[model samples]
Target: MRIGITLTDSRGPDALTRLRDELADAAANGMQSAWLSNIFGLDALTALAVAGSQVPGIEVGTAVVPTFPRHPVTLAQQALTTALAVSGRLTLGIGLSHRIVIEDMLGYSFDRPLRHLSDYLDALLPLLDGEPVDVRRETVRAVAGLTTPRVGRVPVLVAALGPKMLRLAGARVDGTVLWMTGVSTVRDHVMPTLQTAASEAGRPPARVVAMLPVAVTDDTEAARERAAREFEVYGTLPSYRAMLDREGVTGPADIALIGDEKSVRARIEEFGDAGVTDFVAAAFSGPDAARTRALLGELATAA
Candidate 1:
């Protein structure tokens, strides 16, 4: 399994610089990939582009960028531009963000999200592959007049959780970038669904990249408290709450990987056994960034 680190876009003032430094450090420490989250701060693609120049070898990816905020053509163009700038080292992870965020926050109608995503990927994939895209659908349409640098084809990953989306991801996209899903969920639910879909579709088994909160410390109690506080908002969110409930976890502490080196390593192995091809550790809230980095470094080396 490939071991990676997730750069948190949720905090710090010099986020871009910090992300660059972290990627460089991770690369130096022999980590295979580094992923950036698309939450409220710096855009994931832009951050990856900036970090790509700084760290040459490590694979850089977006854990996800919401699809509702941008059209398929626009997103395809942006992803291609970033891929070109990075010399084809970008993985574009796209998703239909939750209804509450789309409807309540952005004031966009949330009906037919699955259809929207299907249409978006159909239009967007051809564009990324340098094929003329001329498709008209209710939610998405693409007129193929634009040209990209054609550096290389950027791999599209779907941020998928449920059955329909996971099936779509297996059939259409390269992989799924999963968040807030535990190993049990991945083993019992996600892997089987994706594998079956891929097998039925006659495609290679879809990559399952698991993103989780990780805090490596002997003070497990303190780490759990910090994780619970840091992930408070996610615990309250409807979609994530449903996933947590399915995992039988009531709080972030239940999901977070917190312990000494041995225990953390065991948790990572558990994820691997559960069929995660890649593991991206988003270190939990803490005072010492260096300590977190060191812990990741140890894991990377040991693995």
Candidate 2:
């Protein structure tokens, strides 16, 4: 399985420099990729574009960018531009963000998210493939196409959790990107459902990219406490809640990869055994932040 680290950036001029240095460090430590999240921070695509200029020998991508705030045409344009600047090392992970951030916070009607995603990708995919898009859907319409200087292949992964989204991702996109979902859920629910859909559609095996909070520490209880405090909001999100319940986990901490080095490495191997294509280690906040990253680096080399 491919190993990577998740990056959450604070906004500033120094962010790009920090990302460049981080990518260099990751490459030096034998890591293969860096995943960035677009959760209320600098634009993920643009940030990656700038950082990719300074780094080499490692891939970079957005863990997820919300689909509601931007139109499909605009996104295609931006993604293509970023892909060009980054020399085609861009994995675009997208999703319909939750109601709390979309409706309550941004004041946009979080209406028919599944339908919106269905429409959104219909336009977004073809355009990214350097095809002329003329889609006419209920939630999205596009009559755009990329000009010259197109990317060869931009692998797209959807942040899909439920069965419907999994089916859609299996049928339409490269694979699925998961968060907070456990090994049992992936083995029983996600992998089976997605692969069945892929079989029906005559597609290749669907990619399962599982992003989990990870730490190498002796104080497992303290790690859980910190993970719970830092990621409590995810526990309240409805989609994440369903996955947690499926895993019989009451909170995010329960699903975290926190333990000593031996235990952490074993946890990562567990995900690989459960059929994860890529295991992206989210640098979970704790007393051993650097230790966690160092372990992830070592594991990447070992893998």
Query: Pick by TM-score: which candidate is best?
Result: 2
Q: How many residue pairs collide in each prediction?
A: 0, 0
Tell how far residue 82 is off in model 1, in angstroms.
Answer: 0.6
lDDT for each candidate structure: 0.84, 0.88
Which ten residues in a row are the worst by lDDT in model 2?
Answer: 144-153
Best by lDDT: 2
Worst 10 contiguous positions by lDDT, candidate 1? 284-293
In terms of lDDT, model 2 sits at: 0.88
lDDT of each residue in 130-156, candidate 1, tens digit only: 888888999887877458887877888
TM-score of each: 0.95, 0.97
| Model 2: lDDT of residue 88 | 85
